[model samples]
Target: MDSRSLPNSSKSSKSSRAEVSVKRSPVEPRVSTLLDVISISMGETG
Candidate 1:
Protein backbone atom coordinates (compact mmCIF):
# COMPACT_ATOMS: atom_id res chain seq x y z
CA MET A 1 0.00 0.00 0.00
CA ASP A 2 1.12 3.54 -0.68
CA SER A 3 1.87 5.92 2.18
CA ARG A 4 -0.67 8.33 0.78
CA SER A 5 -3.33 5.88 1.89
CA LEU A 6 -2.52 6.72 5.53
CA PRO A 7 -3.59 9.65 7.71
CA ASN A 8 -2.15 13.21 7.90
CA SER A 9 -0.99 13.37 4.33
CA SER A 10 -2.10 15.99 1.86
CA LYS A 11 -1.12 16.42 -1.79
CA SER A 12 0.05 19.97 -1.22
CA SER A 13 3.24 19.25 0.78
CA LYS A 14 3.88 15.84 -0.76
CA SER A 15 6.75 16.98 -2.97
CA SER A 16 8.78 18.03 0.10
CA ARG A 17 7.65 15.45 2.66
CA ALA A 18 7.09 12.35 0.58
CA GLU A 19 10.47 10.80 1.30
CA VAL A 20 10.34 11.48 5.03
CA SER A 21 6.70 10.52 5.33
CA VAL A 22 6.96 7.28 3.41
CA LYS A 23 9.84 6.23 5.65
CA ARG A 24 7.69 6.35 8.78
CA SER A 25 6.65 2.76 9.32
CA PRO A 26 3.95 1.72 11.77
CA VAL A 27 6.06 -1.38 12.37
CA GLU A 28 9.76 -1.87 12.69
CA PRO A 29 11.74 -2.16 9.50
CA ARG A 30 12.19 -5.81 8.61
CA VAL A 31 15.24 -7.78 7.63
CA SER A 32 13.25 -9.56 4.95
CA THR A 33 15.57 -8.60 2.13
CA LEU A 34 18.89 -10.42 1.95
CA LEU A 35 20.68 -7.43 0.46
CA ASP A 36 19.47 -5.24 3.28
CA VAL A 37 20.76 -7.65 5.91
CA ILE A 38 24.08 -7.94 4.15
CA SER A 39 24.54 -4.21 3.92
CA ILE A 40 23.67 -3.78 7.59
CA SER A 41 26.17 -6.42 8.66
CA MET A 42 28.83 -4.89 6.44
CA GLY A 43 28.27 -1.54 8.04
CA GLU A 44 28.52 -3.04 11.49
CA THR A 45 31.79 -4.79 10.61
CA GLY A 46 33.37 -1.55 9.46
Candidate 2:
Protein backbone atom coordinates (compact mmCIF):
# COMPACT_ATOMS: atom_id res chain seq x y z
CA MET A 1 0.00 0.00 0.00
CA ASP A 2 2.77 2.47 0.79
CA SER A 3 4.58 1.76 -2.48
CA ARG A 4 1.42 2.24 -4.51
CA SER A 5 0.48 5.48 -2.82
CA LEU A 6 3.97 7.01 -3.26
CA PRO A 7 3.83 7.02 -7.06
CA ASN A 8 0.27 8.33 -7.05
CA SER A 9 1.23 11.26 -4.86
CA SER A 10 4.25 12.10 -7.02
CA LYS A 11 2.10 11.95 -10.13
CA SER A 12 -0.38 14.41 -8.72
CA SER A 13 2.44 16.72 -7.66
CA LYS A 14 3.86 16.72 -11.17
CA SER A 15 0.49 17.60 -12.68
CA SER A 16 0.03 20.46 -10.26
CA ARG A 17 3.54 21.78 -10.93
CA ALA A 18 2.90 21.73 -14.66
CA GLU A 19 -0.28 23.72 -14.27
CA VAL A 20 1.49 26.28 -12.11
CA SER A 21 4.30 26.63 -14.65
CA VAL A 22 1.86 27.35 -17.45
CA LYS A 23 -0.06 29.91 -15.44
CA ARG A 24 3.11 31.72 -14.34
CA SER A 25 4.91 31.68 -17.67
CA PRO A 26 3.94 35.24 -18.54
CA VAL A 27 4.46 36.64 -15.06
CA GLU A 28 7.60 38.41 -13.88
CA PRO A 29 10.80 36.44 -13.31
CA ARG A 30 10.98 37.48 -9.65
CA VAL A 31 7.47 36.23 -8.99
CA SER A 32 8.20 32.97 -10.74
CA THR A 33 11.29 32.43 -8.61
CA LEU A 34 9.30 33.09 -5.48
CA LEU A 35 6.68 30.58 -6.58
CA ASP A 36 9.35 27.98 -7.25
CA VAL A 37 10.66 28.38 -3.72
CA ILE A 38 7.18 28.11 -2.26
CA SER A 39 6.44 24.99 -4.27
CA ILE A 40 9.69 23.37 -3.22
CA SER A 41 8.97 24.09 0.44
CA MET A 42 5.46 22.69 0.11
CA GLY A 43 6.79 19.57 -1.55
CA GLU A 44 9.29 19.04 1.27
CA THR A 45 6.69 19.49 3.98
CA GLY A 46 4.07 17.44 2.22
Candidate 3:
Protein backbone atom coordinates (compact mmCIF):
# COMPACT_ATOMS: atom_id res chain seq x y z
CA MET A 1 0.00 0.00 0.00
CA ASP A 2 2.71 2.45 0.92
CA SER A 3 4.67 1.77 -2.24
CA ARG A 4 1.65 2.23 -4.45
CA SER A 5 0.62 5.40 -2.68
CA LEU A 6 4.11 6.84 -2.98
CA PRO A 7 4.25 6.55 -6.76
CA ASN A 8 0.73 7.83 -7.12
CA SER A 9 1.43 10.89 -5.04
CA SER A 10 4.60 11.62 -6.94
CA LYS A 11 2.88 11.29 -10.27
CA SER A 12 0.04 13.57 -9.21
CA SER A 13 2.44 16.19 -7.93
CA LYS A 14 4.50 16.09 -11.10
CA SER A 15 1.42 16.37 -13.30
CA SER A 16 0.07 19.28 -11.27
CA ARG A 17 3.39 21.07 -11.44
CA ALA A 18 3.64 20.54 -15.16
CA GLU A 19 0.12 21.88 -15.64
CA VAL A 20 0.86 24.99 -13.65
CA SER A 21 3.99 25.63 -15.65
CA VAL A 22 2.23 25.08 -18.95
CA LYS A 23 -0.58 27.46 -17.97
CA ARG A 24 1.87 30.13 -16.94
CA SER A 25 4.07 29.69 -20.01
CA PRO A 26 1.65 31.30 -22.42
CA VAL A 27 0.25 33.83 -19.99
CA GLU A 28 3.62 35.22 -19.00
CA PRO A 29 4.54 36.15 -22.55
CA ARG A 30 1.17 37.81 -23.15
CA VAL A 31 1.43 39.85 -19.99
CA SER A 32 4.96 40.88 -20.80
CA THR A 33 3.95 41.97 -24.26
CA LEU A 34 1.07 44.01 -22.88
CA LEU A 35 3.35 45.73 -20.42
CA ASP A 36 5.84 46.46 -23.12
CA VAL A 37 3.18 47.95 -25.34
CA ILE A 38 1.83 50.07 -22.53
CA SER A 39 5.30 51.35 -21.75
CA ILE A 40 5.98 52.14 -25.38
CA SER A 41 2.71 53.99 -25.74
CA MET A 42 3.37 56.01 -22.64
CA GLY A 43 6.83 56.83 -23.86
CA GLU A 44 5.51 58.10 -27.16
CA THR A 45 2.80 60.18 -25.52
CA GLY A 46 5.13 61.59 -22.91
Candidate 4:
Protein backbone atom coordinates (compact mmCIF):
# COMPACT_ATOMS: atom_id res chain seq x y z
CA MET A 1 0.00 0.00 0.00
CA ASP A 2 2.75 2.39 0.92
CA SER A 3 4.33 1.52 -2.38
CA ARG A 4 1.77 3.76 -4.05
CA SER A 5 3.26 6.67 -2.16
CA LEU A 6 6.59 6.03 -3.84
CA PRO A 7 8.02 8.80 -5.91
CA ASN A 8 7.29 8.51 -9.62
CA SER A 9 10.77 9.90 -10.13
CA SER A 10 11.67 6.84 -12.25
CA LYS A 11 14.92 6.27 -10.40
CA SER A 12 13.07 4.47 -7.55
CA SER A 13 10.99 2.11 -9.67
CA LYS A 14 13.56 -0.69 -9.97
CA SER A 15 14.82 -0.47 -6.43
CA SER A 16 11.30 -0.29 -4.91
CA ARG A 17 10.26 -3.51 -6.62
CA ALA A 18 13.26 -5.29 -5.14
CA GLU A 19 12.52 -3.87 -1.70
CA VAL A 20 8.91 -5.09 -1.86
CA SER A 21 10.05 -8.60 -2.71
CA VAL A 22 12.56 -8.66 0.12
CA LYS A 23 9.90 -7.43 2.56
CA ARG A 24 7.58 -10.22 1.55
CA SER A 25 10.04 -13.05 2.13
CA PRO A 26 9.52 -13.35 5.84
CA VAL A 27 5.73 -13.69 5.47
CA GLU A 28 5.97 -16.54 2.93
CA PRO A 29 5.80 -19.30 5.52
CA ARG A 30 2.90 -17.74 7.38
CA VAL A 31 1.00 -17.12 4.17
CA SER A 32 1.46 -20.72 3.10
CA THR A 33 0.08 -21.99 6.37
CA LEU A 34 -2.88 -19.63 6.15
CA LEU A 35 -3.73 -20.83 2.65
CA ASP A 36 -3.66 -24.42 3.78
CA VAL A 37 -5.95 -23.68 6.70
CA ILE A 38 -8.37 -21.79 4.48
CA SER A 39 -8.56 -24.70 2.06
CA ILE A 40 -9.43 -27.11 4.83
CA SER A 41 -12.06 -24.75 6.18
CA MET A 42 -13.65 -24.41 2.76
CA GLY A 43 -13.79 -28.18 2.40
CA GLU A 44 -15.67 -28.47 5.70
CA THR A 45 -18.06 -25.62 4.84
CA GLY A 46 -18.98 -27.16 1.53
lDDT by candidate, in order shown: 0.66, 0.93, 0.97, 0.86
Report clashes for each candidate as comma-separated counts. 0, 0, 0, 0
lDDT of 2 at 16: 100
What would the TM-score be for candidate 1 when compared with the true structure? 0.31
Comparing 2 with 4 on lDDT, the higher-scoring candidate is: 2
Lowest lDDT block of 10, candidate 1: 24-33
- The 10 consecutive residues of candidate 4 with the worst lDDT sum are 1-10
Candidate 2, run of 10 with poorest lDDT = 23-32
Residue pairs that clash (backbone atoms under 3 angstroms), model 4 = none
lDDT, model 4: 0.86
lDDT of 3 at 6: 98
| TM-score ranking, best first | 3, 2, 4, 1
User: Tens-digit lDDT track for model 1 on 4-36?
Assistant: 655445664575586666676533355346678
lDDT of 2: 0.93
> Which pairs of residues clash in candidate 2, taking residues 3 or more apart in a chain or in different chains?
none
- Show the colliding residue pairs in model 3: none
Tens-digit lDDT track for model 4 on 5-45? 66554557888888999999999999999999999999999
On the 0 to 100 scale, the lDDT of residue 28 in model 2 is 74
**Model 2 residue 23 CA deviation in Å:** 0.4
